[model samples]
Target: MKQSLILTILVTLTSFQRASAIPFQVRADLDSCLNSAGLTSIYPSSSGYASAAQAYNLRFQYSPAALVYPTSENAVAAAVKCAGSLNVPVSARSGGHSYAAYGLGGQDGALVVDLSKLKAITINSDQTATIQTGNRLGDVALTLYNNGGRAMPHGTSPEVGVGGHLGCGGFGLDSRMWGLFLDQALSARVVLSNGTIVAASPSENSDLFWAIRGAAPSFGIVTEYKFKTYPAPSSNIIFSYSYWSTPQATASSIFSAFQTFAQTSAPPTLGIQAILASAGAPGQLYVSLTGVFYGTKSDFNNAINPLLTKIPKPQGTSVVTYGWLDSLVQLGGQSLNTSTTPDGTDTFFAKSLMVPQEAPMTSAAIQSFFNYLGNQGTSSDTVSLTTLYSMHCEP
Candidate 1:
């Protein structure tokens, strides 16, 4: 009797598995998705899917089971619910500016929810900017700049998405004077994991609001962000200083000096970085300190000359002050392209670290890292380096 009962239970489980293995359920849901008039504005067919699959970081491509555009938070919620009901994975894409694999890295047979249609900026009378998740930094900056020269301290690249940057603690030229991008954040509208839309602000949903300010991406997909804005200066100056190192020892000294200058004497108006390389024909053991200053030439020179004196006499120095937009373009190393997000390309691998001081081990680690680059057969010209310097504001 025990053996017979066990056999019946096994048969029942096997029958259930076979019944659920078919795609009929998925197909029915997909048919409904196709007929989703509510999603007609956002859902793209296979032909449309090809273009949407392109990502800013050109490292890879994503092909989703379906592509839907969410015009509003409600639309976004609807799409999320649909995906959940169908038991499909959902990947949210705002400006498609993810540097790593997170943006379009959808699992197999997942729904790629694209939020490009939600690009809108509403500026209230009180100097607050409410931007949709899909808005790019360039557009927002230009708009604010035109509206009485207002600006926010943000990344040097204009094509970056406000959503991605704010989500990850954004920083750029004005970071030292101001702070990380998250510092200016006022609030956000986010969709929870369970398909509910909620407003997160300091006064309402305060815990979620705090989480939204720094780590919204990890917790939920934010649809809109509100930021505090300020009046921007008319023009700015960018000074680039470069030096050649005949030996690795000189390179190490230059790095150490820059570290001391950054920690002890650096000014908030100045943005600085130290670049190192080989000497000779191909050029190795070279170091450079680059800067972007927000003040006048005289004021900037006063702050920079002492710093310059610490390193070897520069082989080349260039100073150009222009309209803020022109200055931003030069900083990004790219001409302005309106159709696509700025600095959105899948061409390189980038990693950043925050170090308080430079030590022998720091130099050794960098040398080792560059050595590994050689092993990977990477040329020096193709590699780019960025070093950040931070200083505390006066009490």
Candidate 2:
């Protein structure tokens, strides 16, 4: 089960928000409504509004009409009912880390429903876990591991909210074996535009069940999710390889070699991605291949050694084993605890896509792409890491 977007009937209102600023009176009216409903809220005039309205990416910042914290499902319904009546747009804020900032309504003056207080993880008698949308990936990881040695497939970012990550396509290093994080969902509780509480699953509201999993932003607000959990693997292999100060030709060959190996021989337990980054100066290419292999150290070596023979020796490389949770902490470069959520922000542009395996790029095409990448003079400020989803063969 997954609770997702609070985007619903008022979605149309978000488009008009940009045409002009919301009336000051409307803000006051919303402030009054929240007060009357007894919901914990912050208004623009409130000192906490600035922090409450903060989005994860510094590239985008939207002024929400009002930020409300609903502690229970009934309270979530009341908040929606209030917004639907006042014609105010609504956006649910879980981790507040949408790449496009859609979590800020993709516009201005929408009512931001902050779900931070709803972080709860319940291990059920069945082989499943019920998680509130407010819990971040790190929170979810630590809670499940500490309680029941349970695990689920999810992205590497710890601050990303479960609502947004799983609502979208939740992919992780282990996705090749377990599929997406969303695939673990059995059902979810949602608050509809009518302010009605409903359960969406395969057998109930089947249409909505499908819609929310892939595109929950336009559907309704999900409060909690019940997911099938897997026993945490005992052994995990985390690996990294970096090529620095490399020429375009070498970078292209490195990426090409990785693609060939990924498509032909990578195991499902092996999840890897190649990163192409712009170094300090123009014509400088920095490439890295990093991911996790969920198996014994000997087995990982047997699988990765063959791929190593195909490419030039990397300037830096690492192949170490760690416990399941430790592997996540190392790969994420942060603590996986909910005690204190991170508040880091960056301004950059990044996009992701998958290249078809049937029509792999010719060596000429690969060279051409790298040629342009090496010539780009953009600095770290404007351009950040660009990752290629090269693990397509790990079906």
Best candidate per TM-score, number?
A: 2
lDDT per residue for candidate 2 within 1-395, as digits (tens), equals 11111101000111111332588878778888888999999887789877777766666677888889999988999998898888899888888778667887878889988888898889999969999999899989998899879999888878888988878767778887787888899999999987899999999999999988877777888999999999999999989889877887888888888878866777878887776765656777888888889999889988888789998999999888999999999978898885665567655444434456566667997787677667753333322232323221110
Candidate 2 wrongly placed segments (more than 4 Å): 1-20, 377-395
Local accuracy of candidate 1 as per-residue lDDT tens digits, 1-395: 00000000000011110111215568458548645737843223445655666656455455456667777788888877777777776767766667643555333455666777888888889998888878777777777777767788777666666777787667667777667777888888988767799998889898998886666666777898888987775557877777654445555556666666665677877776665544433324555677688888898889887777887777878888877777767887664444553344544444444454433235576555444433331233333344454311100
Consecutive 10-residue window with the lowest summed lDDT within model 1: 1-10
- TM-score for model 1? 0.82
User: TM-scores of the models, in the given order?
Assistant: 0.82, 0.90
The CA lDDT at 150 in model 2 is 90
What's the alpha carbon RMSD for model 2?
Answer: 6.2
Off by over 4 Å in 1: 1-31, 41-45, 244-246, 277-283, 334-337, 340-344, 357-384, 389-395
| Model 2: colliding residue pairs | 1-186, 1-187, 1-225, 1-226, 3-222, 4-222, 5-220, 5-221
Q: Residue 133 deviation, candidate 1, in Å?
A: 1.1
Output the worst ten-in-a-row residue range by lDDT, candidate 2. Answer: 4-13
